[model samples]
Target chain A: MIDLLVISPILVPLLTLIVCLIPRISAKTSDAISLTSAGVLLACVSWLLITVVSHGTLTLRAGGWAPPFGIVLVADTLSALMLWISAFVAFVVLIYGVRSGPDALSPGHLHVLIHGLIHGLMLGVNGSFLTGDLFNLYVWFEVMLISSFILMVREGHHSQLPGGLTYVLLNLLASALFLSGAGLIYGKLGTLNLADMAAKLGALQDPDLVNTSGALIFVAFAAKAALFPFHFWLPASYHRAAPAISALFAGLLTKVGVYALLRLFTLVFTPANGFSTTLILYLSMATMILGVLGAVAQYHIRRLLAFHIISQIGYMTAGLALGGELALTAVIFYVLHHIAVKSTLFLVGGVLEARTGSPDIRHHGGFYQSSPLLALCFLIPAFSLGGIPPLSGFWAKLNLLQAGIETGRWLFIATALIVGILTLFSMIKIWNESFWKAPASDHPRPATNTGGRPFLAMLSLCGLTLVFSLGGAFVFRLAQRAAGELADPSGYLDAVLKGGTL
Target chain B: MNSLLLRIAARYLSWPLLVVSLWLLYRGHNLPGGGFIGGLLAASAFMLYELSGYGRPQRGFFSISPFFFMPVGLGVAVLSALPGLLGGAFMKGLWLPGFELPLLGKVHLGTPLLFDIGVYLTVIGFILLLADTLNDESS
Candidate 1:
């Protein structure tokens, strides 16, 4: 039963994708099926979290193969938490996608296909979170890349092609690096199972080959996560997709990269290795400063939010670099907070564009007068993102800063503080220009339709952000437990290798 | 491209190729061939006939849009996992007792065979869909 639960997150989405692919299914029917699938996924993930919390790490040996021979799926607190949060965000985004109407984003006949792709994306995400083997993780990444690529280019707008091309080319390059790294590791250790590799890595005399392969894999994930030099693809392509797609991308995709970094860095490549740790520390700082600075210069709302996504990733990397129980906890907390807040900001940007027919903030004004509710929805996440007191982002940042201070990483702490301020400055830039300033004299505002499903999506995310703030202690405890599990992979290793209770 | 000689060869060769593809898929469980290669083989047979100047076989069985097979294939593939899931683990092969056949001798059947068939169908659909899209682009 538990084994089935472990695979349900992947299974549910696969079934949904298949159902949605039926040729003659109406868009409405596809939406219903996809939405229900998302709901079921969320419930399954939540239940998985409960199980993991009570029972420790859960492992499923695919085809009943013994460890080191066949594929395995392992879910500890970290995996479960990531799965639960993503499932929630996906469910909400599907709601927004459905309510916004099929034609709003996709052309005729492509709507059902898009839903199919969304489920495919979910299957990939869930598989990535649950897989215990390195090659399986690579396979899941391909699944995600293909689904997202089709989703981005499905509308066939000429404007989307360049972004899509860039996105595909860069990601394919990353995948190549990833495959090579996995191949190198397999050749060295004679195994691709993460647990077996971790157990075997320590015994190997030559650390250099392992470190070299590790660096290759790390670079691949960093590219995926949009860290510093590799961050260009994100801002270039994310804004080109439809709003709901953008929201989904902003919320889940890059975070998967971060999750991989955290998982592999903690389990397979411990921070004890000087090469990756030092590399992460420096790259993270650069990512933070540059990402926010880029955001500050953007006038387009979604573009700005996209840059912020990169900047926020820097903080998570910073936590990973810090490398302690506290830092890991903070990273988990920060990721949860950032996913919700960034997604809400993007959805709000979508709503704004829907109303104003422009993503450019300069041409927008007087939302404070016309749509106060929308204004409030934007304000909460914006403030939370900026780390305002009593909001989720504030606590998330505070935990991170606390972790940094404890580690005596004064330089990282100072950079973080400065970046936090710049983050606030950019958020305020959006607020002041779009919400506070009077309507531009020349540009006409379209008719307002503010009370619909898009608003519901944004509001629900805001509600989640509020829950994070109000329930900080509870969430923090969960993060703490998850971090503890990550900080020590003994339980995970034993669970996978010895085979945890079926 | 529309030469009568080429058309006669394609017409004579296509069905035989398809039959061979099914043979490959059936033997794939324990042998070298499987759904992917089999499906590719089957798709190529159709492609050969189309290239012989019949613009996409539109009569009888081939009239159905290749897209229609995708869901059905995926459904079959998913269903193949059910027996194993019920037995305990996912994708765990469950074999039925072997039975003798006239030409084939003893044959063992299992969920893995079903899974290959599913993959066979899905691959055919996917490749044909790509062909259709390319055709649309060219015309």
Candidate 2:
């Protein structure tokens, strides 16, 4: 029965979207339906997290058929953690959408489209994490891509189409590469079940086929994650989406790519291998430096944050490259911190955009005097994102640095530190332009009442990030446990394969 | 610019096309033809109707929004799986014992059939929606 809880998070949003889709469902009713479902989804995922903790790993064979033949949904510590975080983020974003109303929801059909988008996203993401079959993971990725592409182009805004085109074409290409790799793997092994693949690959001892397929899959995830040289599509398109949509994209979308990378590298491709580890290390460093550098050059707040997302991804991958328990732990912690901090910043950007009719920092000012609450929320996450001490980012970065030194990767360590300083410089740049500087001469007067809903959403997300800072000990322990689970997939293998035998 | 020939042909052909689509759908469980092909076949029938009826005011069944098919079909498809929940797992296929129909011989039912029907409706709905959108934009 607890195994059933795994699908609830995916089902709730989908059901809500169905209800909302009913002809003539009022926008208000639709929004109510969406919000309630999101809240329920959060509860379902929380229960899943607790269940996975107590039971170790939970696997469900769809249709009651055994695995290696039937579809399998497996939830270990890592998948559970991701679901918990995604559900929480989805709930907050839903509230933000509700509070902000029609404009925030965007396009015709209002709540119907928005909820449908969220539903598709949840289904894709949760399925990706829970699936034990490699091909099923690809199916989930397509599900996620289609839904997100719709969301990106939802408004039918003129600029959106071009951005949406770039986003769609690149992602489709990535999906093609991913499919080809899957086809190759299937051809070689004759099995698409991930656990089964692990068992088979370990036995087969063919490096060339494995490395080629691995590299192909890596490129696909890299494109999705927006790793350097493949990241131009992100900043170009992400900024064109509505603020709430942007926030959700900023929060969860790319992280799926990161999760896929982490999951594959740990489970299927061993870090002890030479070329793969070196490739991940160099790519991670380049991603970090280039991402923050792009951020430093941006004037639009959302574009700046979008670039920062790419950079933070580098940090997580770098941790993976470091290849130890502590490094993996750092990667997981950094993902958690980055999701909360990045989304909070984007929501803050939304509120700012709502209050002042633009996302351009040059057109905004006087938040220090007028909206102290917004200013405080902005500063906390901004500083945390910059790796200021006592905040979540500091602890995440410190762990990664420690992992680097322990691994004896001095050059990568230097790259991490340099990227950190540049990241701080960029954060300060946003702070100076948006909050610290005097109001631009033609800036609109700050409104006293900016509505409680968006603020509540921002505050709650910020509070989550703050909780990460204040309760660093507990969170780090959880990440440590998740990393341990990730580093060794035998438990996952036992659950899937042994469960099949029964 | 409406094609009188297409209109006449479509008016006579639509019902048979729908029947054929149903035939395809019925054979889909173990055969090559399934909900997807059936749905497309059904949508093509509707597409023919739209082409023949071009520039006329949308009336009767045609007037109903094409977008309606997408959500309703999706809902039905998703709900088809709920019966599987009753059986044990989320998508576990359950079957009814085959029974003789007066005219049709033996008939069997399962959640997968329901799922197929749902997909059929959704694909038809999506095609209609696309056709209608393009038609509206051109006008």
Off-target runs (Cα >4 Å) in candidate 1 are: A99-103, A273-275, A448-451
Cα shift from native, residue B95, model 2 (Å):
0.8
The TM-scores, one per candidate, come to 0.98, 0.95
Which tens-of-lDDT digit does each residue in B1-139 have in candidate 1? 7688988898778889999999999999878999999999998887887787658866755555677778888889989987888777888889999999997788989999999999999998899899989999998
Residue-level lDDT tens digits of model 1 in A84-187: 99999999888888835321557668878898899899899999999999999999999998999998877778988998999999999999999998889889
Per-residue lDDT of model 2, residues B1-139, tens digit only: 4667768898778778988999898789988998999999998877766666654237865455656787878888888887787788888888999999785568878989989999998899888877777878987
Q: How much does each candidate deviate from the true structure in C-alpha RMSD?
A: 1.5, 2.2
lDDT (Cα, 0-100) at B42 in candidate 2: 91
Q: Go through the candidates in order and give each one's C-alpha lDDT.
A: 0.89, 0.85
The candidates' DockQ values read 0.77, 0.60
Model 2, runs deviating above 4 Å = A99-103, A107-111, A272-275, A445-449, A500-502, B1-5, B52-65
Q: Taking the candidates one at a time, how many backbone clashes does each contain? A: 0, 1
